[model samples]
Structures are given as C-alpha cells and as structure tokens.
Target chain A: MKQNLFSPITESMYYILLSLSEPLHGYGIIKKVEEMSQGRLKLAPGTLYGALTNLENNKLIISVGVDPENIRRKLYKITDSGVDLIQIEIKRLEELLRNGKKVYYD
Target chain B: MISQHKLFFAWNEDKEMDYLQKMARKGYIFHHTNFFNYYFEEKEPESINYAADFKGFDKMPEEEYLQLFEDAGWTMVCRYGAWYYFKNMDMDALLYNDYHSVQNKYKKLLLFLLIVGLPLYYQLFIFLPRMSNEALTGFLFGFRLFVYFIVILHFSATLKIFKLYLKFSKNIHE
Candidate 1:
C-alpha cells in the first residue's frame, strides 16, 4: 500500500470525493453532497469549485470533460488514488471513534 | 438606466454588496459597474442578495467558473477584473459556505495584490531617482504627481487587503 498523504482531508473535501464515487458535474456534486449530508453540509459554489480544482490538480479526481447534456458544466470522477485516500480516511475515522468509545466506556 | 458614482475600497467589499442590495430595494437593479460608477436598470422594488468574490480565471476558464455559480442560483451581474459580482433573489443565499473558503479567497487576493504592487513600486523607485531633477519642472512634474497619486492609492488598497487577509487567516477555523 502506498502512503496515504491525503488521509486528513477536510470534511468538505471528503464529502466531495465521496460524492464523485460516480461521475458528477459541479452542481450535481453539490446537490449530491447535500443529499448525502442530509442538508447538514451545504457546499457553496465557490468552495466546491475551489476544492474541485485542487483535487483535479492533486490527481485524486479527473475531469471527464463537458457533460453531454450540458456543454457549460464540466464532469469529474474520482481516480484510483482518490478511492485509496478515501478508504484510508474511513479507516482513520473508524479508529478515532473506537478510541473515543474505549475512553468513554472505561 | 441610471448610474451612481461611488467609491469602494478593497477591504469594504461587503459594504459594496450592501449598497447594491440597497439599490435593488429602491427599484434600481445593479446592471454593471464602469470604473467607480455603478450602473443600474430600473425594476420593480424588490430585495436582492449581492455578493462579491475575488477569483482569477487562470486555473479555470471563465465560462465554466461562471456556469458553476449560475447553477448554484447566483446570477452574474458584472465583473471588474478578477472580482466577480453576483446577485440572487434569495436574500439568504450564500456564495461561500465556510470560513476556510473565504480565507482562501482573501489569501488569493492578497497574493495578487502583492505580485502586482511590488513590481509597480520597484519600477517607480528606479524611475523616480533618475528623473528627480528633471521631473521637478514642466509636464514631467504633473506626470510625477500622477504616478505618486496612483502609487498612494495602490498602497492604501494593498494595506486594506493585507488586514482583511490576516483577519480571514485567523478566523479560518471558525
């Protein structure tokens, strides 16, 4: 396993990556994130765009080009690297919960 | 359409947004801005939310960048350089959801200001000394004064933006 340097991503970044498990356009990802977070995390357009650019630059996400239906909107999807990072993050989060539960119960 | 002359400082963009909102309430929908004047088209008196964001199109194309905002319910009003103006009928609509993103925006603006302003100051320094004796008279004197005024304006704006950047940096976690 390669070292997961991108493990500790922000809540927004994590949700964004998770939303792109299936390919999605910018606005689609925003809506999907809201659905996933149950309205708790509203990803603003500017914030989402910034994260998208950063993720693309880091090679965690790749732009799949313009949407077929909408030429204006660009689509993106998680790369293998993105999946690896997210899995690592999930494990780290589980460990955090486990540690907290242990201290609370003991 | 009517135009109102207004002066806005870099640090007080919120105030500019507020002014636009106020204008909209008075049946003057903000159309665009040309230099220091804000142009407006008359419309039914209604409240509108105005937002200003500083973002360059260097990494992303302008069309795609704008389409994202449009999809998020913000209508583009106009753009002055890298500062894009947007409006939404929903008063509660927010273009930025968190402090971290807002902080990053400020950081980008500060970086841009420094990049542009530093070179200008350097050029001014180099040219001023060589022209000092000659520039003190005639058309050169007026030209020197103009340059000084522009530099002073730039310096004040840079200072304001720096303070705003620091504030955002400190509040990033919030």
Candidate 2:
C-alpha cells in the first residue's frame, strides 16, 4: 500500500482533522477541539484559520456551508482522505503504545 | 480628537506592538493603521492584549476571517486590507498557537509586500527612465531621483518583509 505523506500528523493537525468530521465553522473547530481535548489543545483563531486553508488546499477538508448569522463564517467538513489519514495516525499511535508497554513490562 | 501618528519600521512588529501597548498603558487606544500611519485616540488605561495578523494572502472569505478571531474572544480594532488588529482582555490570548501558522501569517505579508514591490521595480526600469529627455531630463533630474528613492524604499520594505518571513519560518516545525 502506498503511504500518504500526511499519515504522521501532528497532534494539533490530528485534532483539527478530527474536528472536521462534523460540519463546523472556523470558530466551531476551535471550540470543539478545546472541548474534545478537555482544554488540553486550544487553537488560536489565526492558526486555526491557516491550518484550515492548508487542509482544504490539500483536499483533506472541504468548505461545506456558511453560517446563517454570519456570511463570512464558512463551515468545513473532512473528506474521505482526511478520515483515512487520521485512522492511520491512530494506528501508528496505538502501535507506539504497544511497543512502549511491551518494553516497560519486560 | 488628537490622533498620534507615526510610521513604524518594516519587519519590526515587536517594536510597533510595544509602542501600541505603551500608548494603551498611558490612556491611548489605537484605532487605525495604514501602511505608513498609526492613528490612536486617548482612552482610560487598562491592561490589554494586542495582536495583529497579516491576512492579505488568505484564501478564505473575509467574513470568515474576522469571525474566527471574534470567536476566539479577540475584538477587532481596525483593519487595512491584509493587516488585522485585535485586542483581548486576557493576558494569554495570542493570534497564533503554532509557529507554523505564525510563519504563514508573515509569509502572506511577505507575498503582499513582494507584489507591491514588483510594480515599483518594473516601473523603475520601464516607465520612469522613458520620461527622460535632454532639456526635460536635466530639469527633472531631481524628480527622477525622487521617484527612484520611492522605488528603493519599496524594495527595502519587500526585503524586510521577506526577512521577517524567513525569520518566522526558520523556527517552524513541520
């Protein structure tokens, strides 16, 4: 299987990609990521905006809709590629934990 | 209302931000900043968080851009195209959480500056020299020099912005 270049996503990118599983506006992603991470990963607006642009450009996410209250608030949702990338990342992390646990118990 | 005006140096956002914060500490709140002038109005002093993001190269819609910052609790003070100014009451609030995105902001500014410089660069070689003639050339020698000076200034800004972009990019992790 050909590996995706973005398989080893950073923790921030992981949360952001995961957050995009549901349709969310820019602010919604920030709020959702913070909530999901239990305030452990707070995204600043500017950073989150940049990442969203990059992710969209890479075809991992798509602008799905706009907010009713604000014309400028575009909502984003992850694509199948993004979901696949995150799945690979999760398995990578799981394997890492398995290896570390094996070593610790030995 | 008396508005303080000053031209800040290119690539020196820290000094510019410091000046704004100092003004805020002394009862002045910044209202607008174009490329060359910063306009401020006096107000009651309080501890405030100030930040700026260069968004001219943004691929997203403008409404989406500002709303994100608003959601993050930053109040937009003023904007001039690419330059966005914001303030927050929280001391820890920042415009960027990651160094990569911070670099992206500067890179966008650099791209805009480069675009601004290109026409000036082209004009320096294309149109300005074409205006020179014997009698007119001698009479407008000083005018030509002044135009050249402005073009050079544009080039300098372009260079400084590129330098800032590289400075931010160097520390950014993949």
Candidate 3:
C-alpha cells in the first residue's frame, strides 16, 4: 500500500475509521465520533455521508450488514487496509506531538 | 413491505427525472422535500386498489404527467426541467427566487460601489487637501467626519450582503 495515500485522510476521517472498528450504523457512528472527540466536533449528516462514501470508495471501509433490529439501517466495518492506515496515522501524530512539544517548551 | 436503498447523483439535469421515475417505479419514495432530498420505498397499501391510486401517478415521468394534464385540458409550462419542478413547487421556487434576488442585489450593490463610490471617495480625498488655505483648514479639521461617512457606507454595504446571505440560508432551511 502506498504510505502517502494514507496521508490524505483528515483528522475526522481517522477518528471515524477508529470508531468503526466494530460494526456501526449511521447514528452509532455519529455518537461514537462525538464521544471520541469529547463533543468537540459534531458531524452533520451531509459531512458524515460524504466521508463514508469516500472511505468506502477508497476500500478503507466496507458495509457489513443491516442492523437486525432496524431493517432500514446499515452497519459498516473497517477493512484490514484501514487498520494498517490507522496505525500509520497514529505514528505520524505521535511524531508531530513530540516535535511540537520540543519546539514549544524548549 | 418497505425497502430502503441509497441514492446517488452527479448533478446532471438531463438524466435526473428519468432516474427518479425509474427509482419510483421500483417502489422508492422521497421522504423530504427540502435542502437534502431523501428517498425510500414501500409496498402499496393492501386496501387500496393499485390501479385506482392517483398518488402512485405522482411518481410518473413529467412528460407523461404533463400529457395527463393536457388531456384534462390544463396548460403546463416547463421550468427548470428537472424532478424538483414537479414535486415541490412553492418551496423550491421561493428558495430559488430568494437566492436569485440576493445574488442580483449583491451584484448590483458591488457594481454601484465599484463604478461610483471608490472614484468619488478618491477624488474627495485628493481634492480636499488642495483647496484654498481656509477650505484646506476646514477640510483637515473635518477629515474625521468624512472618514465617518465612508465607514458608515462600508458598514451598510457589508450589512446588506450579510442580510442577503441570512435570507438565502433561511429559505433553504425552511
């Protein structure tokens, strides 16, 4: 996989992928994203749908099945490629934080 | 039984209505009429004879619908030439008209200021410094007052543009 291809993912996209480690339908993903961000970010339906479409198109995520309780619903899960991308993003963010701390404090 | 499916489009006006009709014939139903159009589908009600239902005819193509209207001796005018024109006329037209007016109003206001205001301000700024000693003294003393008028005009123009955006957004939400 191209390492640079993972760099195009935004912070929100990273967190959204993280939230979908387990299967999640639309509202569940929204709730998880909010919880992960501690309510700092709220994803509107339009923005969430747009991100979902892009992620699915990139093969970073896949629709698993409909929620059993709600037949109208859909559930999605992260692909193996998405998990690898997430690991890369975490390492990149750690390096950024380390550099930022050194420059700001020193 | 109801079946829900995802809808996708790339903003093409030509193929939009045919796509909507195809979706509708396959039992899809539009849920919302505003900014984001949402669609779903369900089976016909058992008590209702599907052949006698006028509501199902709502899903028919515009040309066919217009022909039905014409057969009934009503005249129809085609505007926008898309799915939106047939379904939600009052709301869609009001939103479009408001957006158009706001856009036109801002264009005219900006043109007026660019063509007239900037040159007029520049002339006054330059000429006020070159007047007779007495007039020059007076103009220098009143420079703040002149600046104040310019500031007010700038503020008014900014407010008008802001108001237009607010109205445009409000119409979309409604």
Candidate 4:
C-alpha cells in the first residue's frame, strides 16, 4: 500500500505540500496544516519554513510572491511535481485503507 | 567617550592589591581624568558610570589595554569570538546546549552506522557461505540502494534541522 514513489517523502512533507496546493504564506501554511491534521501536528515556525525551503529546493513548490502589504512574508504554491506527488500519496493511502478493511471485515 | 569600570572583589592590602590600584591610577592619568567608576562585588551599585570620552578607545589601533591588563595580573577570561556580538548576556547555556545537541546528534548517528553496519555487511557477504554469490551480489546492491535512500533522508533531515536552528537564532537576535 505504501509502495508508491511519493511514499518516500515523509508524511510531514506530504501534508506540507498538500497545504501549499493553494498559495499560502508561512503562517497560513502552519495554520492550515494544524487545522487539517486535526491538531495532531502543530508545526513550529522553524519546521514550517524548513519544510517550505526543502520543497522549493526540490522544485515541488515555488514561491509565488510577497504580499505587498507585508514584504517580510513570502507566499508559495505547489508545482506540477508537487501535485503529482500528492496524487501518488493519496492513491497509496487509499490502497492501504482498502487492504486493511478487507483483512478486518472479510 | 572611553569609560572604565573597576570591580573590587576583596579589601586586601597586599602587593597584588597595590598593583591593581597603581594600574587603575595609571589608566586614569594616561587618559587624563578620573573617568572611571568603582563597583564593589558584594553590593548593588547605583548608576553605572560609563565613560563618555571613551569613543576612540573602541577604535584604538591595537588592543594594547588587553596586554596591559594581563601584565597587571588580571586574567582575561573571555574575549570576543565570531558570534560575540550576537551572544546573549543571559541564556548562554540554552544557546550552547542547542548548538551542541544538534552537533552531537549528527556525530552519534554517523558513529552508530559505521560501528554497526560495517560489521553486519561484512558478515553477510564474506562469512555466510550458504548465501550464494548471486544472492550476495543482489544483497550488496540492495544495501547500496538502502544506503542511498538513507543518505537522502539524512540530507533532508539535516536541512530541516539547520533551518530550524537558523530561525531560532534569528528570533533570539530580533
């Protein structure tokens, strides 16, 4: 179930990439990850920026632009590679759930 | 303006004590004024007197005073290093711990892999004869792939840790 190419990228990386599918600034990404994770993950500012930088370096995401009102902040959006990876991850997870349900129920 | 502050630890009247007093007096005369304040170690002093005319001293061509202080039997405990300006007067221990912990974690991981993985690989390939040469070759290839995978993971993790450290240090400075 976890055999997909994107499974090597960590759950944190997957979630972070998912968060940036829409353009998001640093804080916005953190809040989205937390909310989406159901508070299971609370990303510190350091962790969030680290993940963002890594994703950008890997070309999985690209910085869109800085908000005109807050130049210190930068916004980012997922790239084609990122969207592809997320799709792979979703398929992998779905497979895992399917196998688990079959094993448990049938 | 250059200012001087004197810290007195004890009230002994020995030659060492006398020497310190002489040095202090000379320092004052050389600068041509009593532009200094004395602080007793035991008491909380009011109004630290920072010498106003000490500006040029910071820009002094050489650190002559440092040698002079050493010659006067004063131990130079601390001096400015690379991060001297960014260092906090308090929370030094916390910052030091953070730096050392990150360094030690990397060191330990490297050490563990070297100590454990090398012998295990040697035993698997060289000692185990029942494992066919083709099987051994495949195992070695798989091992190399595993190592490559681990290298990528470690590289990513290291980048993340470094970014976290940079963010923390920058926050502290701000």
Candidate 5:
C-alpha cells in the first residue's frame, strides 16, 4: 500500500474500502456502498472504475477472478493492508468525535 | 439510416450528448459517427441519457473498459477517435460522480493536445518564415494554407480544453 494513502482518504474511498468486506464486482461494490451509506452515496460507474484501478495499483485491493454468474465482470476484494488502513481511519474518527464532544460539553 | 453532418467541440461535449439525446427523442437513434457526420437509424421515439467520455483506448483493453460501463447499465453506442459514447435509459445515471474524476479527464485531454499540437505548431512557425516567394506561390502554398487552417483548428481546440481544465480544477473543491 502507498505510505500516504490513508492520511485521511476521500469519503468515496473509505466507503469503497468498507464495501469490500466481501468479494464483489464493480457494480456490486456500487450497490454495496449505497446500501452501507443508507442510499446516500450512489457511486457512478466511471468514478468507481477509476477508484478501483487506483486502489488495485496501490495494492489496497486485488482482483480475485471473473464473476461466475457474469463472466464479463471481475470480482475484487480488499487486502490486509486495506483492513489495517480502515482500522486506523476508525481510530482517527473516534478521536475526532471525542474531541468534538469535549468541546460541546465545555 | 440517415446521416447528418455536424461539428462537435471537444471542450463542450455536453452539447454533443444533448444533441444525441434530442435525436433519440425524435425517433432518430444515433448509430455511429464517421468523419464529421453522425449516422442515425429510425426507431421508436424514446428518452435516453447520452454521455461522452474523452478517453483514448490505449491504457486498458477496450473490452474491459467497456464492460465496467455495461455492468453499470450503460450501453456503448460508438467510439469516435478518443471519445466513447454511451447511453442509458435512466436519466439520473452519470458516468462520473465526483468533480476530481471529471477534472482529471479534462487534464488528460489538455496534456494530449499539448503533446501532439505543440510540436506541429512549432514546426509550422519555424518552417513557414523561411520559405521563399517561389515556394510560397507554388502548388505547395495551397497545402501550406491547409496546414495553417489545421493548426488554427488545433490551437483553438487546445485553448478550449485548457479553459475547461481550469474550470474543472476550481470546481474540484466544491
């Protein structure tokens, strides 16, 4: 994985990483992101494709193989590095939330 | 099939998409484009969302690039040069969701124009001034004029794409 990738990734990138808890194809990832975000984040095809390529290049995600149901579609899953990045992001978010709450109560 | 001659500007390709969508609504479904003509076949009038992506078929296999769009419910209409045309029945479907990706597309286009156009312009400017009156007035002069016209077109196209790149760059923050 790139050293500076998770220095606070984009919301789309975070959602995409979270959606890959299971192996999914391009369109499946879009649906998964929408579902995870409660239909608030609908990824466009081009955006998802570009992001997938970037993630794969950075070794954050890896394509397993073609989807059996649809031969034209390829399935992708997050790497261990991806999971580690997500954990770091969650910790960072929690720290921010704790700081915000402290300010709110003061 | 009926063919209509039309000129599409690269920087404002939304106009081309709009034109294609309008034709689809008028029972003239766009088939493909050749040279400066757009060919359309008669079909039932239907509302379609047409999108134009300015990308060359060099980086990845065309099949793989197209499959992604196809899986996302887009139908590939045709590819003219560096432009890929797609259509979908859903009007809300977009090819690009974020400003960054859109800006990157324009940036790539601008870079390509500069790489290809700058050398041609430089060569033209350097060679034109040294040509003697004898060569300037000969049959080659017509060819020279054609070259000048082409260079002018190329310059304008580069200028327009550069402007679009600047506009999209500003929009990335929003």
Candidate 6:
C-alpha cells in the first residue's frame, strides 16, 4: 500500500530496485548488491526477502523467472514503474547533493 | 547429552536462541529440538555463528531451498518447524540486517494466535452461561481463569510486537 514509491526510498530499497533492473534471483541479488556497493552493502536474507515481497506488492518489480536448480529462488526484474522510481530517486538525490554543495563549497 | 527446557513462542524466541548459542560455545553443539527439549552433542569449544528465520511454503524441494543458503555459505543446521536454523560458514552470514523483516516473523506468530485463540474464545463463551450450579460454577471459574490468563498473555505479546515494529520503523534502514 505504499503508493508513493519515491517519497522516501531507503538505501536497501534503492539498491534492491536497482539490482532488479536485470533479472536476478534471491541469492543473485545479494551477491550483486555487495558487488554493486563495492562490498559496502551487506544484505540479509530476511531483509532481501521482505523487500522483494513489498516491491512486488507495489508493482515496482515482477517475477521474471526462477532458478533452474532451485525453483524457490525466483528471479526478479524491475518494471516500467520501477524504472520511473529510479529516475525520480536519482533526481531527488542530485538535489540533495546540489544543496549540500552550495553551502559547503561556497 | 539431551537437556529439556520450556519454550515460549513470543517473548522467549531470542532467549531460546541465545541459550543454544551459549551451549554451543561450551562444546555442546545443538543437535535437534523437540517440544520441550533441546538435544546437544559434545564438540570442541570454538566460536560458531548461528541465525534463525521464519519462512513459509511454496518453498518446494527443501534441499534446494537450503542449497541457496548453503551456496551463500550458510549451512542449514535444522528446520524443526517454521524456524530454520543455520550456522555461518563465513562472516557474511547474517540472516537479517534490518528489523523490518524481523517484524514479518512476529506477524506470522500473531496470525497463528488469532487462528488458534479465536476458536477457543468462542467455545468458552458458549460453555460459560450453562454452568449455573455451585460445583459447575467452581469448575467454570477455574477454567475461565486459565482462559483469561492466556488472553492477557497473547494481548500483551501482540502489543509488544506492534511497539517493536513501530520502534524499528523509526530508525530503520528500510
């Protein structure tokens, strides 16, 4: 029921939605998130699983496929809506950076 | 040797886990769990990591469900019921990073209480009015006491979980 997708995106949600731009399963997303963040983002199974549920519920992501060996490891990909979220989030963060720069750099 | 201990679902879950962890440190690696007993086998006293999570069905082929964790270097130790216990093979073995997902576990527990508790409440309501005689009244009074105790326990527990969820939401990373 969180319809306002980009109102407040947490760091974990940001990475998770970004990771799903391409199809990735549960463990795949975990590994990718760590690699994507240069070992900074350490995602837990419970958090990842719950985020996945919420993301799907909000229609930001969709199940694309499943791991061949393990059917439970369903692959996920960002939807068109999710793409819009990424763009909006990027702009919002850019504004924050610009405002910080004006005070600190000036 | 196997040791028996009581288990309470709502409040004592963390304590139950800690008790097992301490036993593991003392060279008593936890073997399996029953309703009231946690069996442990002797082993060398060394640091071992353990984590637990609650998950549900559509988790077909339990081997593969576990293999995903195994691939991530978390060896599945046991799956007694909904609780899946694992031991870390490496440092990146945290089962949960944020309290939001941890809240999901309590939600499931609350659902279970509603399912089991509602019917009992209904049955007691029907039985209470019929006990008019002194002997029956005494029996009903004692039984009602037991029922009321459980109602208080469950109510307090549910409220506690809701408060925890709210607290977690405040400073939460997700």
Question: How many clashes in candidate 5?
Answer: 0
Q: Model 6 clash pairs?
A: none
Return the top candidate by DockQ.
Answer: 2
Q: In candidate 3 chain A, what residue range of length 10 has the lowest lDDT sum?
A: A41-50
TM-score to true structure, per model: 0.91, 0.86, 0.40, 0.39, 0.85, 0.81
For model 1 the local lDDT of residue A79 reads 98
Candidate with the larger DockQ of 1 and 6: 1
Best by TM-score: 1
- Candidate 4 retains true contacts at a fraction of 0.00
Cα lDDT of candidate 4 equals: 0.47
The model with the greater lDDT, 2 or 3, is 2
The per-model DockQ list reads 0.65, 0.69, 0.01, 0.01, 0.51, 0.46
Off by over 4 Å in 5: A1-8, A80-106, B125-134, B172-174
For model 4, how does the per-residue alpha-carbon lDDT over A1-106 read when each residue is reduced to its tens digit? 3244445565667778889878977667667987999987655332343455567777899978876766545678999988888888788778878999999988
Candidate structures ordered by DockQ, highest first: 2, 1, 5, 6, 4, 3
Query: What does the lDDT come to for candidate 3?
Result: 0.52
Candidate with better TM-score, 4 vs 5: 5
Candidate 1 stretches with Cα past 4 Å from truth are A1-7, A102-106, B172-174
What TM-score does the first chain of candidate 4 have? Answer: 0.85
Q: Look at candidate 4 and tell me the lDDT of residue A17.
A: 89
**What tens-digit string does per-residue lDDT give for candidate 1 at B1-174?**
999999997789889989999989999999999789999999998899999888854587888899999999998999988989998988888988877777778778878887888767875898777877755888888877887888998898888877876776775352
Q: Stretches of candidate 6 above 4 Å error?
A: A1-6, A69-72, B56-68, B111-115, B120-142, B172-174
Residue-by-residue lDDT tens digits, candidate 5, B32-126: 99787999999999999999876642354566678889988888999887788899999999999887777767776877888788767875987
Error of 4 at B85 (Å): 13
DockQ, prediction 5: 0.51
Provide the TM-score of chain B versus the true chain B for each model in turn: 0.93, 0.85, 0.29, 0.24, 0.92, 0.75
Tens-digit per-residue lDDT, B1-174, candidate 2 = 346667776478777877888888888788887767777787898777888778876578777778888988998999877678899989788888877777777777777777777877776788776865752556477767876898877778778777777776787364
Candidate 4 at B137: error in angstroms? 53
